[model samples]
Target: MSLLVDTANRDTLHTLLLKLTADTKPLWGKMTPQQMIEHLIENVQYTNGTLIPICRRSPEEALEAKQRGLNPDVQIPKNLFLGDLPAEYAYLNLPASVTRLMADLELFDRYFKTNAMAIHGGFGPMDYNEWIIWHSKHFTHHFRQFGLIEGDI
Candidate 1:
Protein backbone atom coordinates (compact mmCIF):
# COMPACT_ATOMS: atom_id res chain seq x y z
CA MET A 1 0.00 0.00 0.00
CA SER A 2 1.22 3.50 -0.87
CA LEU A 3 1.29 6.22 1.75
CA LEU A 4 1.05 9.85 0.73
CA VAL A 5 4.62 11.22 0.77
CA ASP A 6 6.44 13.54 -1.62
CA THR A 7 6.39 17.33 -1.95
CA ALA A 8 2.78 17.45 -3.05
CA ASN A 9 1.48 15.71 0.06
CA ARG A 10 3.50 17.93 2.37
CA ASP A 11 2.50 21.03 0.44
CA THR A 12 -1.13 20.05 0.47
CA LEU A 13 -1.09 19.35 4.18
CA HIS A 14 0.63 22.67 4.81
CA THR A 15 -1.83 24.60 2.64
CA LEU A 16 -4.81 23.17 4.42
CA LEU A 17 -3.10 23.78 7.72
CA LEU A 18 -3.12 27.49 6.97
CA LYS A 19 -6.80 27.59 6.13
CA LEU A 20 -8.06 26.18 9.41
CA THR A 21 -9.80 28.60 11.75
CA ALA A 22 -11.83 28.24 14.89
CA ASP A 23 -14.98 28.21 12.84
CA THR A 24 -13.82 25.97 10.02
CA LYS A 25 -16.35 23.22 9.48
CA PRO A 26 -16.08 19.93 7.64
CA LEU A 27 -18.04 20.22 4.40
CA TRP A 28 -19.40 16.69 4.72
CA GLY A 29 -18.80 15.27 8.17
CA LYS A 30 -20.02 15.27 11.74
CA MET A 31 -17.12 16.74 13.74
CA THR A 32 -17.18 20.27 14.99
CA PRO A 33 -13.79 21.94 14.53
CA GLN A 34 -12.82 21.23 18.12
CA GLN A 35 -13.92 17.64 17.80
CA MET A 36 -11.94 17.28 14.60
CA ILE A 37 -8.90 18.71 16.35
CA GLU A 38 -9.40 16.16 19.10
CA HIS A 39 -9.72 13.42 16.51
CA LEU A 40 -6.41 14.32 14.92
CA ILE A 41 -4.76 14.48 18.32
CA GLU A 42 -5.93 10.94 18.94
CA ASN A 43 -4.46 9.83 15.63
CA VAL A 44 -1.07 11.25 16.53
CA GLN A 45 -1.22 9.65 19.93
CA TYR A 46 -1.85 6.28 18.37
CA THR A 47 1.06 6.82 16.02
CA ASN A 48 3.26 7.48 18.98
CA GLY A 49 3.49 4.65 21.55
CA THR A 50 1.42 6.61 24.04
CA LEU A 51 -1.90 5.25 22.89
CA ILE A 52 -2.82 1.77 21.74
CA PRO A 53 -6.36 0.74 20.93
CA ILE A 54 -7.52 -2.83 21.26
CA CYS A 55 -6.66 -3.74 17.71
CA ARG A 56 -6.88 -7.35 18.82
CA ARG A 57 -10.06 -7.61 20.82
CA SER A 58 -9.99 -11.26 19.86
CA PRO A 59 -7.93 -13.42 17.54
CA GLU A 60 -10.69 -12.85 15.03
CA GLU A 61 -10.54 -9.10 15.48
CA ALA A 62 -6.84 -9.11 14.72
CA LEU A 63 -7.40 -11.32 11.73
CA GLU A 64 -10.24 -9.17 10.46
CA ALA A 65 -8.23 -5.97 10.78
CA LYS A 66 -5.30 -7.61 9.07
CA GLN A 67 -7.21 -9.36 6.30
CA ARG A 68 -5.82 -8.46 2.91
CA GLY A 69 -9.33 -8.61 1.53
CA LEU A 70 -10.14 -5.33 3.22
CA ASN A 71 -10.08 -2.25 1.05
CA PRO A 72 -7.06 0.08 1.26
CA ASP A 73 -9.16 3.19 1.66
CA VAL A 74 -8.37 5.06 4.87
CA GLN A 75 -11.01 4.77 7.53
CA ILE A 76 -12.34 8.02 8.92
CA PRO A 77 -12.97 7.14 12.53
CA LYS A 78 -16.53 7.50 13.83
CA ASN A 79 -17.60 8.72 17.27
CA LEU A 80 -13.95 9.64 17.67
CA PHE A 81 -14.71 11.28 20.97
CA LEU A 82 -16.12 8.13 22.45
CA GLY A 83 -12.65 7.15 23.66
CA ASP A 84 -10.61 8.45 26.56
CA LEU A 85 -8.52 11.57 26.05
CA PRO A 86 -4.81 11.24 25.49
CA ALA A 87 -3.12 12.55 28.61
CA GLU A 88 -1.11 15.14 26.73
CA TYR A 89 -4.24 16.63 25.22
CA ALA A 90 -6.21 16.42 28.42
CA TYR A 91 -3.46 18.29 30.24
CA LEU A 92 -3.43 21.21 27.81
CA ASN A 93 -6.38 22.92 29.49
CA LEU A 94 -7.05 25.21 26.59
CA PRO A 95 -10.54 26.53 25.98
CA ALA A 96 -10.06 27.94 22.50
CA SER A 97 -10.37 25.28 19.85
CA VAL A 98 -8.04 27.09 17.46
CA THR A 99 -5.39 27.36 20.13
CA ARG A 100 -5.78 23.68 20.84
CA LEU A 101 -5.43 22.96 17.12
CA MET A 102 -2.16 24.84 16.95
CA ALA A 103 -0.93 23.07 20.04
CA ASP A 104 -1.84 19.71 18.55
CA LEU A 105 -0.02 20.51 15.32
CA GLU A 106 3.06 21.53 17.24
CA LEU A 107 2.88 18.35 19.26
CA PHE A 108 2.52 16.38 16.02
CA ASP A 109 5.60 17.95 14.48
CA ARG A 110 7.63 17.10 17.53
CA TYR A 111 6.31 13.56 17.65
CA PHE A 112 6.81 13.03 13.94
CA LYS A 113 10.42 13.98 14.28
CA THR A 114 11.14 11.34 16.91
CA ASN A 115 8.55 8.59 16.59
CA ALA A 116 6.84 8.27 13.23
CA MET A 117 8.00 4.68 13.02
CA ALA A 118 6.41 3.72 16.31
CA ILE A 119 3.32 2.35 14.62
CA HIS A 120 -0.12 1.26 15.70
CA GLY A 121 -2.48 -0.33 13.21
CA GLY A 122 -4.54 1.47 10.65
CA PHE A 123 -4.12 -1.71 8.74
CA GLY A 124 -1.03 -2.95 10.59
CA PRO A 125 2.38 -1.94 11.94
CA MET A 126 3.66 0.84 9.68
CA ASP A 127 7.20 2.11 9.57
CA TYR A 128 8.00 5.82 9.82
CA ASN A 129 7.70 6.25 6.07
CA GLU A 130 4.28 4.64 6.01
CA TRP A 131 3.07 6.70 8.95
CA ILE A 132 4.22 9.93 7.33
CA ILE A 133 2.50 9.06 4.10
CA TRP A 134 -0.72 8.18 5.85
CA HIS A 135 -0.59 11.34 7.92
CA SER A 136 -0.19 13.59 4.91
CA LYS A 137 -2.85 11.80 2.93
CA HIS A 138 -5.39 11.89 5.73
CA PHE A 139 -4.76 15.58 6.39
CA THR A 140 -5.10 16.39 2.72
CA HIS A 141 -8.28 14.38 2.47
CA HIS A 142 -9.90 16.35 5.27
CA PHE A 143 -8.73 19.70 3.92
CA ARG A 144 -10.08 18.85 0.50
CA GLN A 145 -13.39 18.04 2.09
CA PHE A 146 -13.34 21.66 3.26
CA GLY A 147 -12.73 22.79 -0.36
CA LEU A 148 -9.18 23.98 0.25
CA ILE A 149 -6.39 23.73 -2.31
CA GLU A 150 -3.08 22.04 -1.72
CA GLY A 151 -0.30 24.56 -2.26
CA ASP A 152 3.31 25.40 -1.51
CA ILE A 153 4.41 25.13 2.10
Candidate 2:
Protein backbone atom coordinates (compact mmCIF):
# COMPACT_ATOMS: atom_id res chain seq x y z
CA MET A 1 0.00 0.00 0.00
CA SER A 2 1.08 3.55 -0.61
CA LEU A 3 1.98 5.68 2.40
CA LEU A 4 -0.44 8.18 3.95
CA VAL A 5 1.84 10.87 2.55
CA ASP A 6 0.10 10.02 -0.69
CA THR A 7 -3.28 11.67 -1.13
CA ALA A 8 -4.91 8.53 -2.47
CA ASN A 9 -3.76 6.42 0.46
CA ARG A 10 -4.86 9.09 2.90
CA ASP A 11 -8.29 9.11 1.33
CA THR A 12 -8.42 5.35 1.46
CA LEU A 13 -7.52 5.36 5.11
CA HIS A 14 -10.18 7.93 5.90
CA THR A 15 -12.79 6.06 3.94
CA LEU A 16 -12.04 2.87 5.84
CA LEU A 17 -12.02 4.68 9.18
CA LEU A 18 -15.51 6.05 8.53
CA LYS A 19 -16.78 2.50 8.32
CA LEU A 20 -15.96 1.88 11.96
CA THR A 21 -18.73 2.41 14.52
CA ALA A 22 -19.23 1.75 18.24
CA ASP A 23 -20.34 -1.82 17.60
CA THR A 24 -17.33 -2.75 15.55
CA LYS A 25 -15.31 -5.52 17.17
CA PRO A 26 -11.67 -6.31 16.91
CA LEU A 27 -10.63 -9.59 15.35
CA TRP A 28 -8.08 -9.62 18.18
CA GLY A 29 -6.99 -7.51 21.16
CA LYS A 30 -8.82 -5.60 23.89
CA MET A 31 -9.44 -2.12 22.44
CA THR A 32 -12.96 -1.03 21.70
CA PRO A 33 -13.50 0.76 18.39
CA GLN A 34 -13.28 4.19 19.98
CA GLN A 35 -10.26 3.14 21.96
CA MET A 36 -8.62 2.03 18.73
CA ILE A 37 -9.32 5.38 17.14
CA GLU A 38 -7.99 7.22 20.15
CA HIS A 39 -4.94 5.01 20.12
CA LEU A 40 -4.24 5.98 16.52
CA ILE A 41 -4.78 9.66 17.23
CA GLU A 42 -2.44 9.47 20.19
CA ASN A 43 0.20 7.88 17.99
CA VAL A 44 0.01 10.83 15.61
CA GLN A 45 0.20 13.16 18.58
CA TYR A 46 3.37 11.38 19.58
CA THR A 47 4.76 11.76 16.07
CA ASN A 48 4.02 15.48 16.27
CA GLY A 49 5.60 15.73 19.72
CA THR A 50 2.23 16.68 21.18
CA LEU A 51 2.31 13.65 23.46
CA ILE A 52 5.81 12.52 24.19
CA PRO A 53 6.39 9.25 26.00
CA ILE A 54 9.69 8.41 27.59
CA CYS A 55 11.82 6.32 25.27
CA ARG A 56 11.46 2.73 26.40
CA ARG A 57 14.04 1.17 24.12
CA SER A 58 17.77 1.90 23.95
CA PRO A 59 19.17 3.40 20.76
CA GLU A 60 20.28 0.08 19.37
CA GLU A 61 16.98 -1.56 20.22
CA ALA A 62 15.09 1.38 18.76
CA LEU A 63 17.08 1.14 15.56
CA GLU A 64 16.35 -2.54 15.29
CA ALA A 65 12.67 -1.94 15.81
CA LYS A 66 12.69 0.80 13.20
CA GLN A 67 14.36 -1.40 10.65
CA ARG A 68 11.94 -4.25 11.24
CA GLY A 69 8.90 -2.00 11.36
CA LEU A 70 9.76 -0.20 8.15
CA ASN A 71 9.92 -3.44 6.27
CA PRO A 72 6.74 -3.64 4.21
CA ASP A 73 6.71 -7.42 4.43
CA VAL A 74 6.71 -7.42 8.21
CA GLN A 75 3.42 -7.24 10.03
CA ILE A 76 3.11 -6.08 13.62
CA PRO A 77 2.93 -9.08 15.87
CA LYS A 78 -0.54 -9.90 17.19
CA ASN A 79 -1.02 -9.27 20.89
CA LEU A 80 2.35 -7.57 20.74
CA PHE A 81 2.22 -6.69 24.42
CA LEU A 82 2.77 -2.95 24.67
CA GLY A 83 1.77 -3.10 28.33
CA ASP A 84 -1.62 -1.83 29.43
CA LEU A 85 -3.41 1.47 29.19
CA PRO A 86 -4.14 3.54 32.28
CA ALA A 87 -7.15 2.57 34.35
CA GLU A 88 -8.59 5.98 33.60
CA TYR A 89 -8.02 5.79 29.87
CA ALA A 90 -10.79 7.58 28.09
CA TYR A 91 -12.08 7.64 24.51
CA LEU A 92 -14.14 10.07 22.51
CA ASN A 93 -17.28 9.15 20.65
CA LEU A 94 -16.42 7.17 17.54
CA PRO A 95 -17.14 9.90 15.00
CA ALA A 96 -15.26 12.50 16.98
CA SER A 97 -12.32 10.17 17.37
CA VAL A 98 -12.22 9.49 13.65
CA THR A 99 -12.41 13.19 12.87
CA ARG A 100 -9.57 13.96 15.21
CA LEU A 101 -7.51 11.21 13.64
CA MET A 102 -8.10 12.66 10.17
CA ALA A 103 -7.13 16.12 11.38
CA ASP A 104 -4.08 14.78 13.15
CA LEU A 105 -2.96 12.96 10.01
CA GLU A 106 -3.20 16.21 8.11
CA LEU A 107 -1.14 17.77 10.85
CA PHE A 108 1.35 14.98 10.38
CA ASP A 109 1.82 16.12 6.78
CA ARG A 110 2.28 19.68 8.00
CA TYR A 111 4.49 18.69 10.93
CA PHE A 112 7.41 17.31 8.98
CA LYS A 113 7.60 20.34 6.74
CA THR A 114 8.93 22.67 9.45
CA ASN A 115 10.39 20.28 11.99
CA ALA A 116 13.21 17.84 11.47
CA MET A 117 11.65 14.81 13.22
CA ALA A 118 10.53 13.26 16.49
CA ILE A 119 11.79 10.40 18.60
CA HIS A 120 9.62 7.31 18.33
CA GLY A 121 9.54 5.31 21.58
CA GLY A 122 10.68 2.23 19.70
CA PHE A 123 11.90 3.57 16.39
CA GLY A 124 14.28 6.18 17.77
CA PRO A 125 14.21 9.42 15.71
CA MET A 126 12.42 9.36 12.35
CA ASP A 127 12.27 11.69 9.37
CA TYR A 128 9.35 12.29 7.04
CA ASN A 129 9.78 9.23 4.83
CA GLU A 130 10.53 7.03 7.80
CA TRP A 131 7.44 8.32 9.57
CA ILE A 132 5.44 7.60 6.45
CA ILE A 133 6.41 3.96 6.55
CA TRP A 134 5.99 3.67 10.31
CA HIS A 135 2.57 5.29 10.34
CA SER A 136 1.43 3.30 7.32
CA LYS A 137 2.42 0.06 8.94
CA HIS A 138 0.79 1.14 12.18
CA PHE A 139 -2.50 1.98 10.52
CA THR A 140 -2.43 -1.24 8.59
CA HIS A 141 -1.69 -3.18 11.73
CA HIS A 142 -4.67 -1.81 13.65
CA PHE A 143 -6.98 -1.85 10.68
CA ARG A 144 -6.22 -5.51 10.23
CA GLN A 145 -6.64 -6.09 13.95
CA PHE A 146 -10.11 -4.55 13.89
CA GLY A 147 -11.08 -6.42 10.71
CA LEU A 148 -11.70 -3.08 9.07
CA ILE A 149 -9.90 -4.17 5.94
CA GLU A 150 -8.91 -7.63 4.80
CA GLY A 151 -5.29 -8.64 4.30
CA ASP A 152 -3.31 -5.38 4.04
CA ILE A 153 -4.23 -1.76 3.43
Candidate 3:
Protein backbone atom coordinates (compact mmCIF):
# COMPACT_ATOMS: atom_id res chain seq x y z
CA MET A 1 0.00 0.00 0.00
CA SER A 2 1.19 3.50 -0.81
CA LEU A 3 1.45 5.54 2.37
CA LEU A 4 1.96 9.08 1.18
CA VAL A 5 2.01 11.90 3.72
CA ASP A 6 -0.86 13.93 2.38
CA THR A 7 -4.04 15.19 4.03
CA ALA A 8 -5.76 11.93 3.19
CA ASN A 9 -3.30 9.74 5.05
CA ARG A 10 -2.00 12.00 7.81
CA ASP A 11 -4.53 10.79 10.33
CA THR A 12 -3.87 7.20 9.43
CA LEU A 13 -0.15 7.70 9.91
CA HIS A 14 -0.69 9.43 13.22
CA THR A 15 -2.91 6.59 14.36
CA LEU A 16 -0.23 4.11 13.43
CA LEU A 17 2.28 5.95 15.55
CA LEU A 18 -0.12 5.96 18.47
CA LYS A 19 0.28 2.21 18.69
CA LEU A 20 3.86 2.53 19.83
CA THR A 21 4.80 2.82 23.51
CA ALA A 22 7.82 3.33 25.69
CA ASP A 23 8.28 -0.41 26.22
CA THR A 24 8.18 -1.27 22.54
CA LYS A 25 11.17 -3.22 21.31
CA PRO A 26 12.54 -3.63 17.83
CA LEU A 27 12.49 -6.84 15.85
CA TRP A 28 15.64 -5.60 14.15
CA GLY A 29 18.06 -2.72 14.60
CA LYS A 30 19.42 -1.28 17.84
CA MET A 31 17.40 1.92 18.32
CA THR A 32 15.16 2.22 21.35
CA PRO A 33 11.65 3.58 21.01
CA GLN A 34 12.66 7.04 22.13
CA GLN A 35 15.65 7.08 19.84
CA MET A 36 13.52 5.92 16.94
CA ILE A 37 11.01 8.71 17.53
CA GLU A 38 13.84 11.23 17.71
CA HIS A 39 15.26 9.87 14.49
CA LEU A 40 11.92 10.28 12.72
CA ILE A 41 11.55 13.85 13.99
CA GLU A 42 14.98 14.70 12.64
CA ASN A 43 14.09 13.34 9.22
CA VAL A 44 10.80 15.27 9.17
CA GLN A 45 12.71 18.40 10.03
CA TYR A 46 14.93 17.77 7.03
CA THR A 47 11.90 17.68 4.75
CA ASN A 48 10.47 20.75 6.50
CA GLY A 49 13.67 22.63 5.57
CA THR A 50 14.57 23.11 9.22
CA LEU A 51 17.62 20.85 9.11
CA ILE A 52 20.14 21.05 6.27
CA PRO A 53 22.96 18.64 5.70
CA ILE A 54 26.57 19.61 4.93
CA CYS A 55 26.98 17.17 2.06
CA ARG A 56 24.75 16.85 -1.00
CA ARG A 57 24.58 14.67 -4.10
CA SER A 58 25.42 15.94 -7.58
CA PRO A 59 22.68 16.34 -10.19
CA GLU A 60 23.47 13.03 -11.87
CA GLU A 61 23.55 11.23 -8.52
CA ALA A 62 20.27 12.85 -7.49
CA LEU A 63 18.64 11.72 -10.71
CA GLU A 64 19.76 8.17 -10.07
CA ALA A 65 18.59 8.27 -6.47
CA LYS A 66 15.21 9.61 -7.47
CA GLN A 67 14.85 6.85 -10.03
CA ARG A 68 15.75 4.28 -7.40
CA GLY A 69 13.24 5.80 -4.98
CA LEU A 70 10.52 5.40 -7.56
CA ASN A 71 11.24 1.71 -7.90
CA PRO A 72 8.77 -0.34 -5.87
CA ASP A 73 11.19 -3.22 -5.42
CA VAL A 74 13.90 -1.04 -3.95
CA GLN A 75 13.81 -1.54 -0.19
CA ILE A 76 14.81 1.30 2.07
CA PRO A 77 18.40 0.83 3.11
CA LYS A 78 18.83 -0.87 6.50
CA ASN A 79 20.76 0.31 9.54
CA LEU A 80 21.46 3.66 7.94
CA PHE A 81 22.91 5.96 10.58
CA LEU A 82 21.94 9.51 9.76
CA GLY A 83 23.77 11.07 12.72
CA ASP A 84 23.73 11.64 16.45
CA LEU A 85 20.62 12.94 18.21
CA PRO A 86 20.56 16.48 19.50
CA ALA A 87 21.42 17.04 23.16
CA GLU A 88 17.87 18.07 24.06
CA TYR A 89 16.50 14.76 22.84
CA ALA A 90 19.31 12.68 24.30
CA TYR A 91 17.39 11.96 27.50
CA LEU A 92 13.86 12.26 26.16
CA ASN A 93 11.37 9.61 27.17
CA LEU A 94 9.41 7.66 24.59
CA PRO A 95 6.09 9.37 25.32
CA ALA A 96 7.57 12.83 25.06
CA SER A 97 9.52 11.90 21.97
CA VAL A 98 6.43 10.53 20.30
CA THR A 99 4.52 13.70 21.15
CA ARG A 100 7.29 15.81 19.63
CA LEU A 101 7.45 13.60 16.54
CA MET A 102 3.69 13.87 16.02
CA ALA A 103 3.91 17.63 16.30
CA ASP A 104 6.73 17.69 13.77
CA LEU A 105 4.75 15.51 11.40
CA GLU A 106 1.84 17.92 11.60
CA LEU A 107 4.14 20.86 10.91
CA PHE A 108 5.74 19.04 8.02
CA ASP A 109 2.39 18.22 6.52
CA ARG A 110 1.42 21.88 6.53
CA TYR A 111 4.82 23.04 5.28
CA PHE A 112 4.86 20.55 2.42
CA LYS A 113 1.80 22.00 0.72
CA THR A 114 3.36 25.38 -0.04
CA ASN A 115 7.05 24.42 -0.13
CA ALA A 116 8.56 23.94 -3.56
CA MET A 117 10.97 21.13 -2.69
CA ALA A 118 13.17 19.49 -0.08
CA ILE A 119 16.78 18.34 -0.14
CA HIS A 120 17.08 14.78 1.04
CA GLY A 121 20.45 13.97 2.56
CA GLY A 122 21.21 11.10 0.20
CA PHE A 123 18.49 11.34 -2.41
CA GLY A 124 19.11 15.07 -2.98
CA PRO A 125 16.35 17.41 -4.22
CA MET A 126 12.78 16.13 -4.24
CA ASP A 127 9.48 17.72 -5.10
CA TYR A 128 6.45 17.47 -2.80
CA ASN A 129 5.27 14.16 -4.22
CA GLU A 130 8.75 12.67 -4.05
CA TRP A 131 9.06 13.83 -0.45
CA ILE A 132 5.74 12.17 0.33
CA ILE A 133 6.97 8.88 -1.08
CA TRP A 134 10.27 9.17 0.76
CA HIS A 135 8.62 9.98 4.07
CA SER A 136 6.16 7.13 3.68
CA LYS A 137 8.96 4.70 2.95
CA HIS A 138 10.99 6.07 5.85
CA PHE A 139 8.11 5.80 8.37
CA THR A 140 7.27 2.33 7.13
CA HIS A 141 10.91 1.33 7.42
CA HIS A 142 10.98 2.32 11.08
CA PHE A 143 7.58 0.80 11.77
CA ARG A 144 8.93 -2.43 10.38
CA GLN A 145 11.95 -2.11 12.62
CA PHE A 146 9.72 -2.07 15.67
CA GLY A 147 7.44 -4.85 14.40
CA LEU A 148 4.59 -2.32 14.36
CA ILE A 149 3.79 -3.39 10.82
CA GLU A 150 3.51 -7.06 10.09
CA GLY A 151 5.08 -8.71 7.01
CA ASP A 152 7.38 -5.76 6.47
CA ILE A 153 10.57 -7.22 7.84
Candidate 4:
Protein backbone atom coordinates (compact mmCIF):
# COMPACT_ATOMS: atom_id res chain seq x y z
CA MET A 1 0.00 0.00 0.00
CA SER A 2 1.16 3.54 -0.64
CA LEU A 3 2.33 5.19 2.57
CA LEU A 4 0.10 7.99 3.88
CA VAL A 5 2.36 9.74 6.35
CA ASP A 6 3.91 11.79 3.64
CA THR A 7 2.79 15.06 2.07
CA ALA A 8 0.86 13.38 -0.70
CA ASN A 9 -1.15 11.13 1.55
CA ARG A 10 -1.96 13.95 3.92
CA ASP A 11 -3.20 16.05 1.05
CA THR A 12 -5.31 13.18 -0.20
CA LEU A 13 -6.88 12.63 3.20
CA HIS A 14 -7.65 16.30 3.47
CA THR A 15 -9.30 16.31 0.09
CA LEU A 16 -11.28 13.20 0.89
CA LEU A 17 -12.47 14.67 4.18
CA LEU A 18 -13.69 17.69 2.29
CA LYS A 19 -15.66 15.38 0.07
CA LEU A 20 -17.55 13.95 3.09
CA THR A 21 -20.44 15.70 4.82
CA ALA A 22 -23.62 15.21 6.81
CA ASP A 23 -25.72 15.01 3.69
CA THR A 24 -23.40 12.39 2.27
CA LYS A 25 -25.24 9.24 3.21
CA PRO A 26 -23.46 5.97 3.06
CA LEU A 27 -24.18 3.34 0.45
CA TRP A 28 -24.32 0.85 3.32
CA GLY A 29 -24.80 0.87 7.07
CA LYS A 30 -25.99 3.77 9.15
CA MET A 31 -24.25 6.74 10.73
CA THR A 32 -25.13 10.35 10.97
CA PRO A 33 -22.55 12.95 10.01
CA GLN A 34 -21.61 13.49 13.62
CA GLN A 35 -21.47 9.78 14.20
CA MET A 36 -19.06 9.41 11.31
CA ILE A 37 -16.83 12.15 12.66
CA GLU A 38 -16.78 10.59 16.09
CA HIS A 39 -16.12 7.23 14.52
CA LEU A 40 -13.10 8.50 12.66
CA ILE A 41 -11.83 10.24 15.77
CA GLU A 42 -11.92 6.97 17.65
CA ASN A 43 -9.56 5.47 15.12
CA VAL A 44 -6.84 7.90 16.10
CA GLN A 45 -7.82 8.04 19.74
CA TYR A 46 -6.96 4.36 20.12
CA THR A 47 -3.33 5.35 19.72
CA ASN A 48 -3.58 8.72 21.39
CA GLY A 49 -3.56 7.31 24.94
CA THR A 50 -7.20 6.29 25.10
CA LEU A 51 -7.73 3.06 27.01
CA ILE A 52 -9.84 0.56 25.09
CA PRO A 53 -10.30 -2.73 26.86
CA ILE A 54 -8.99 -5.60 24.90
CA CYS A 55 -11.88 -7.65 23.50
CA ARG A 56 -10.40 -10.62 25.38
CA ARG A 57 -9.46 -12.68 22.42
CA SER A 58 -7.66 -15.92 22.99
CA PRO A 59 -3.92 -15.84 22.50
CA GLU A 60 -4.27 -17.69 19.20
CA GLU A 61 -6.97 -15.42 17.89
CA ALA A 62 -4.99 -12.34 18.77
CA LEU A 63 -1.87 -13.69 17.14
CA GLU A 64 -3.65 -14.70 13.97
CA ALA A 65 -5.34 -11.35 13.69
CA LYS A 66 -2.06 -9.58 14.22
CA GLN A 67 -0.41 -11.59 11.48
CA ARG A 68 -3.13 -10.58 9.08
CA GLY A 69 -2.78 -6.93 10.15
CA LEU A 70 -3.16 -4.67 13.15
CA ASN A 71 -5.07 -1.39 12.79
CA PRO A 72 -7.52 -2.69 10.18
CA ASP A 73 -8.49 -5.76 12.17
CA VAL A 74 -8.32 -3.90 15.44
CA GLN A 75 -10.98 -1.49 14.21
CA ILE A 76 -13.44 -4.16 13.08
CA PRO A 77 -15.23 -4.50 16.40
CA LYS A 78 -15.67 -0.76 16.69
CA ASN A 79 -17.25 -0.27 13.28
CA LEU A 80 -18.76 -3.65 12.40
CA PHE A 81 -19.40 -4.73 16.01
CA LEU A 82 -20.23 -1.66 18.01
CA GLY A 83 -20.84 -1.39 21.70
CA ASP A 84 -23.02 1.34 23.19
CA LEU A 85 -22.12 4.77 21.93
CA PRO A 86 -20.68 6.96 24.62
CA ALA A 87 -23.18 9.38 26.06
CA GLU A 88 -21.04 12.33 25.08
CA TYR A 89 -20.82 11.37 21.40
CA ALA A 90 -24.21 9.72 21.08
CA TYR A 91 -25.62 13.21 21.05
CA LEU A 92 -23.78 15.44 18.57
CA ASN A 93 -25.51 18.67 17.65
CA LEU A 94 -23.65 19.43 14.47
CA PRO A 95 -25.27 22.50 12.95
CA ALA A 96 -24.15 21.35 9.54
CA SER A 97 -22.42 18.23 8.35
CA VAL A 98 -20.05 20.11 6.09
CA THR A 99 -18.89 22.38 8.90
CA ARG A 100 -18.56 19.46 11.26
CA LEU A 101 -16.63 17.44 8.74
CA MET A 102 -14.27 20.33 8.14
CA ALA A 103 -13.60 20.63 11.84
CA ASP A 104 -12.98 16.91 12.09
CA LEU A 105 -10.61 17.03 9.17
CA GLU A 106 -8.63 19.77 10.82
CA LEU A 107 -8.50 17.86 14.06
CA PHE A 108 -7.32 14.73 12.29
CA ASP A 109 -4.71 16.61 10.36
CA ARG A 110 -3.33 18.23 13.47
CA TYR A 111 -3.20 14.99 15.41
CA PHE A 112 -1.72 13.03 12.55
CA LYS A 113 0.96 15.58 11.82
CA THR A 114 2.28 15.36 15.34
CA ASN A 115 1.84 11.72 16.27
CA ALA A 116 0.78 9.65 13.32
CA MET A 117 3.42 7.06 14.08
CA ALA A 118 2.74 6.63 17.76
CA ILE A 119 2.44 3.05 18.89
CA HIS A 120 0.27 1.92 21.75
CA GLY A 121 -0.36 -1.44 23.42
CA GLY A 122 2.60 -3.77 23.80
CA PHE A 123 3.48 -3.73 20.12
CA GLY A 124 5.98 -0.89 20.53
CA PRO A 125 6.26 2.15 18.27
CA MET A 126 5.60 2.24 14.54
CA ASP A 127 7.26 4.37 11.89
CA TYR A 128 5.48 6.94 9.76
CA ASN A 129 5.30 4.56 6.82
CA GLU A 130 3.45 1.92 8.79
CA TRP A 131 1.16 4.52 10.27
CA ILE A 132 0.31 5.92 6.86
CA ILE A 133 -0.38 2.54 5.37
CA TRP A 134 -2.76 1.67 8.18
CA HIS A 135 -4.43 5.06 8.23
CA SER A 136 -4.91 5.22 4.47
CA LYS A 137 -6.52 1.80 4.43
CA HIS A 138 -8.91 2.89 7.15
CA PHE A 139 -9.83 6.17 5.46
CA THR A 140 -10.39 4.33 2.21
CA HIS A 141 -12.68 1.82 3.88
CA HIS A 142 -14.95 4.49 5.29
CA PHE A 143 -14.79 6.64 2.18
CA ARG A 144 -15.93 3.69 0.10
CA GLN A 145 -18.74 2.92 2.53
CA PHE A 146 -20.06 6.42 1.91
CA GLY A 147 -20.20 5.66 -1.81
CA LEU A 148 -17.19 7.80 -2.61
CA ILE A 149 -15.27 6.08 -5.37
CA GLU A 150 -11.59 5.33 -4.71
CA GLY A 151 -10.14 7.75 -7.26
CA ASP A 152 -13.03 10.17 -7.41
CA ILE A 153 -12.08 13.73 -6.62
Q: Per-residue lDDT of 1-153 in model 3, one digit per residue for the tens?
A: 454333237677777777888788888677877778888888888877578753277888878988897665677767777666455555357777777777776777677778787787767777777876777777778887887776543
Per-residue lDDT of model 1, residues 1-153, tens digit only? 333323234445444556666576667666554555566666766765557644434555544554432334644343334455344444243245445444555555566677544545535555565555566556545554555643222
Two-way lDDT contest, 3 vs 4, winner: 3
lDDT of 4: 0.52
Please report, in order, the local distance difference test score of every candidate based on alpha carbons.
0.51, 0.78, 0.72, 0.52
Of 1 and 3, which scores higher on TM-score? 3
lDDT by residue for model 2 (129-153), tens: 8887788778778888888767753
CA displacement after TM-score superposition, residue 24 of candidate 3 (Å): 1.2
The list of candidate 1 runs beyond 4 A from truth reads: 1-15, 57-117, 150-153
Question: Which model scores highest in lDDT?
Answer: 2
**Candidate 1 lDDT (Cα, 0 to 1):** 0.51
TM-score of predicted structure 4: 0.57
Question: Candidate 1 at 28: error in angstroms?
Answer: 0.6
Q: Please list the Cα RMSD from the true structure of every candidate, rounded to 1 decimal place.
A: 6.4, 2.7, 2.8, 5.8
Ranking by TM-score: 2, 3, 4, 1
Over the full model, what C-alpha lDDT does candidate 3 score relative to the true structure? 0.72
Show the lowest summed lDDT stretch of 10 residues, model 1: 1-10
